[model samples]
Target: MYFDIAYYFRVLRHVWSLKQWPGKRGMLFRLLLVVPLVSAFHALCFLLDYVFFPRLWRQTVERPVFIIGHARSGTTLAHRLLAADGNQFSYFLYWELFFPSLLQKKLIRALGRLDALLGSPCLTRLQRWDDKTFGPTRHIHHMSLWNAEEDQFVMRAAFVTQQWALDVPMMDKIDLFHLDQMSDKKRRRWLHHYRECVKRQLLLNGGERTHLSKNPLMCGWVAALQETFPDARFVVMLRNPNECIPSTLRLLELSWKGRGWQPEQYRESLRVMTEISFESIRHPREVLAGHDQAVFVDYRKLVAEPRDTVHEVYAALGLTVSPSFDAYLRAQQDRERNHQSRFTYNIDDYAVSVDDIEGELSELFDEYQWPRLSRRSDLVKSVGP
Candidate 1:
């Protein structure tokens, strides 16, 4: 009952103010009071952040490093492991997931100072000091830690909405692939917006040489990406569709519950997400034709031996193994000790049958060594909590 109520409210929060809710704008207008209030809060945050924190310029230079694979394929685990090298560039744990950079760039140092002054750095329990994050996520827009994270960028920028995200539309019209036919003029514009955003991140963090980012959108645009970043390396995490789909469905269900209020209302969205499940197998070989650095790391393997797997990943990405990297890796493990406690879910409702799972992920199962389960037992010991 509690889950149901919480889920409904979440959906309301997501859909209430968006395109679906009609009277929401009126509330937003009435909440103009919040603008000034938040502005003051933001400005005060700015003064504090600017004063205390070292002003960083993002080190988001185009590098051949990446942590990828299909959805739920240890990308987060891998990205977090590689992130430990202070030299390997990445957004800080707080900033990457919470993209509040526009203001942070100018005032994050001061914000920290202010927080210390208050004896409240204002860290949320939600702000895990160490957690693995995977995304081409960058800080582009706000300064509030409440900003939406990376996948939103994929959904909106890639133009892969609920309806046609997986339908294989004309290559030119597809979001990521669309870049292929973009007039040199238009393509550069998108790249510029993207690059500048990344550059801002690099500017904020100094001495970072390699830019390793991850995104599931790359599942379909292997050729175009290789061409764009000719020196770019790939690390596609392979997960069986059976496991990946149910996990993805659960995630989408959670998101929908948080934002839209009713699952029935989001039928199309649920369907879109369901089809996106098989995305990995639909275009696998194209992901890594002959790039030596292009690796397909098994999530299960990494889950079993995280440190060793991470080390292998760094070596594959051509990054040097350093004590600093190991330190960061250790710190991340400590953070994970408590992550599961914060999440609540109903797994019974999420029951994904073996047949349905196989039907969806058959391609990935046949291609990769990802385990296939006839019942949930085969996956029970499959690893990676």
Candidate 2:
């Protein structure tokens, strides 16, 4: 059934008020509409929850797994591979953002299946809920759908609570980090709920011994993750920082998008990412040293010899190599492959010498001995820029 009459009227009022606002075009539209809509949505959820079926709200966590690395670090690919075990179920698209005590959970899952068959499920430019490869999952929020760990829900909490203008710049800033000035107690509350949201996925899935997941944002929060689940294993994917820097710049560029950015934000994000990615790798290595729980994999190795690499990971995790898993691997074998992002960035694009950008990652690149494009250029020049 459609919502109550008051709900319909409220929505109409929201839409009509939206048409009147002069500042609705830019950040203003989101600032105004997102607040009340999200607020109403959240309230409607709690109101219907428990009082209704209460079962969907009470499911226990089934299994817990995680995929952790910086953005664009092949974490998405890993999510696909690990989650491919057909025996182990994952939350589908619609259940992502949808919170309906019970009516919606059953309703949404049914619709998601139908939507997948009827046509495409691509919801936002960022991702799709449909059955296509080469895409990340987002948009739909349901209790049933497994989600890559995202701050969007948490950040949405802040948005609804404070209406802290989620314009393009703020999003870029939030992308970098969100709990900048909150007190320790408040920050802990944010983190607690964040993990709770993740734990809920394990509840929705079969709650197996192994809970598989991946999130690019988790890199910065490695310590927090270790604090929460000491047994949690992290697989950090590494690429040459010189290549990583440009790829990170591109990812940020994708987010800033239409808004004009201060040249400094791009440079700063690059510089910050360079530091954080390496720190994310090193600090966890140092902290989790004796634990032997965290593993680092090379992206090139993953794409080239996926079977061997995946086998290595499974072996390390102590998973009994099942024949069913082998079939799963074959199915995923020739799937959407990696697109090496290094070639996407030309030396001329940044208006800075490769050496200059390479300088930020000097410590990491040198330690890992991944050659610089500058060094490669010199090698080419000696032989035949």
Candidate 3:
């Protein structure tokens, strides 16, 4: 409901200055027409929620769990695994993020129930559409409307999300990642709005379950989040920069290509993103070091021994794994053992090098014993998909 009018106009001007291409034109159209229209509609619905669901104001977000990490780290795996404990947590499903208003969500649920009663024709069609929309990137990052997803999309309508960089490649101009650097007034405004959204979700999910959120870009907001939710718990997912950096660059390159951006258009943005990736690894650990409520997860262990890793995480957070969730974890063991990533990446393809990564994060590399590539041929090999 809190539209970033200045940021929206700034992006609009930048997008308009670009030379016309099919992709640029499409983005221009969305920037000028589609986004504004949708934002207005969402704002209207958000206002109506106060009158229709007044109890939402009484809901409190207490002891929420936040999962933060660099992109393409094991954040998604950890989030989904914890989300499977549905009785203990409430999260934003991919589709629910699009409808942030409590009234709209309630209405959609009622309609979904009716659709189910009528043989699920609508649900089936939605699934087909979801597959078609996300199928191409499935290997890069598995996506589903029903799956618990990053909560950053809750701010998309407000034009405050990093997701726009995927379509516009304007990361050099946009500063969505640096909440800790923003003016105090602006930082508090955005976090207040975000907290309101979380409260709405908490109320929607029966008003008792702990709010669970996973956002890789939240690495920048560690301080702000702590200030906003003093009782919040954190899980920091870590992987070798040798692996995450290139994989993140590859994903961004593919997204920009799909959106019709040329290499020259996005090359600088990619460089900026690479630097941010390094900080994403360093910032959270430095800030949360020795903090009792924060736990760090190694990517290798998370993927190779998910159940054990999750058990350790639960113990660290003073949470008990329920019988049903324990059974779910046991069922996932064979699947985790057999899992493999279809996507592949080479570190040499990006602007940064292994030496640069190690030079900047030598402590992490040494602490985790992340293997180093000694030759160019080894660097070309997959780090871990």
Candidate 4:
């Protein structure tokens, strides 16, 4: 996202606050290259906003729909299903996270059109490369430049996000626990940058559609989000911690590999998992307690009964599921049935036991009567007397 020189400096200053480097010379060199490229883009965005699109800052955002939970809790799938109701949701793409300026987005679109007209395979090649890298984990989480992405990447532009910890080992310090203690002024600044990016996406979508974001990081920012968008609606996805934690660690390791950076081992992964699980359990309670518009969708229900789940989500949010949206959902479900995941796991993958996960998430599982690890098979069956 575009920001002023001052904001860029603030973010850089935070990056420099790291007292340790958790990578080799190669990762350090990559960061050197990234620094100047981002700096140039930042300056260019400043000029473009001031000279051409000053009105973007004035665009108002309405009741945005936030899809939030711990990572790998079906957030990507849920976001994909919801965004397919294109008439109702204005969304962010994976590439937009890197170039969030209005001018940059226009340039990307123009280049895409030119590539198509010239019969060039540049864009197709990139998508294929993404497929090759991400296809194996498609059942867990998927990524592409064109698909709806988590807002945490956009928040990374402000240099305050857990996503940053994946590559920049120094960023590991800013987990949910650390963020909860962030100064009020710094927290506000971070959220303001987040707002600026979301507003720009809304402007690009022509300003009428409701903005839909699938930012798992926002799970820890329920209080801040409430303060900013008092009318925003939330869809909190619920999955067993036994499954979510290891899969999340797998995703983080893959992210590091994709970026040519090194991934942290057991200790860091455990720290992230414990904190995210705690927040995943607690954040929904905070949101539902403070707002009348929040809804929780069980991951089991979503995977087993996609159609009914979507209907219930719409009803909870007081929105209608258009016929076209329903058709899209059914088609996707039919196609995926042929390729459903056989992937399974045990809590031992994360160097933790079932008792540990239960202890960490005791309140949530007990409150909801969620099935324990041994009985997770019942998730696929319909719940009835």
Candidate 3 local lDDT, residue 201: 93
Question: Among these predicted structures, which one has the highest lDDT?
Answer: 3
Residue lDDT tens for model 4, 1-385: 3333443454345456544534445444544577557756765784586467777757888898999887767787788889888889998888888776777787788998999998869987987888887687655556676788886677554444454455554334445433335678766766677777788788887878899998777777777777778788999988876667666655565566675554343356556666666777676676577466888888877877778888999999999988888888888775544445655544454556667777877887887677676554532321110
Q: Which has the higher TM-score value, candidate number 3 or candidate number 4?
A: 3
lDDT of 3 by residue, 1-385 (tens): 7998888988888878877655667888888889989999999998998889889768899999999999878899899999999999999999999888888899999999999999999999999999999998776678989989999889887888877777788899888888987988878888888998898999999999999999999998998899999999999999988888888898889889877688998999998998899889988998898899999999989888999999999999989999999999999988877787778888877778889888999998899999987788877644342
- Considering every candidate listed, which one attains the maximal TM-score? 3
Once fitted onto the true fold, the runs of candidate 3 whose alpha carbons sit more than 4 angstroms away are 381-385
TM-score of each predicted structure versus truth: 0.64, 0.68, 0.97, 0.83
**Which pairs of residues have clashing backbones in candidate 3?**
none
> How many angstroms is residue 355 displaced in model 2 relative to the true structure, after the best TM-score fit?
3.9
* Candidate 2 lDDT, 135-159, residue by residue in tens: 3322111122354433224334333
TM-score of 1: 0.64
Task: Give the range of the ten consecutive residues with the poorest summed lDDT in model 2.
Answer: 376-385
For candidate 3, give the lDDT of residue 56.
77
Q: List the residue pairs that clash in candidate 4.
A: none
Rank the candidate models, highest TM-score first.
Answer: 3, 4, 2, 1
What lDDT tens digits, residue by residue, belong to model 1 across residues 1-385? 0011232233335434366654456545533454345445544543454345444332336664655556665665566556556576554343442233444544656766777787654653324432223221221111224332232142222222322222211122233433445466544544544544455455555535666676565565555556656787777787656555566566566555654447565556555545545655456455576668677777666665667767776687776777877876666664544333222233335445567667765666776766666554354322132
lDDT of each: 0.50, 0.50, 0.88, 0.69
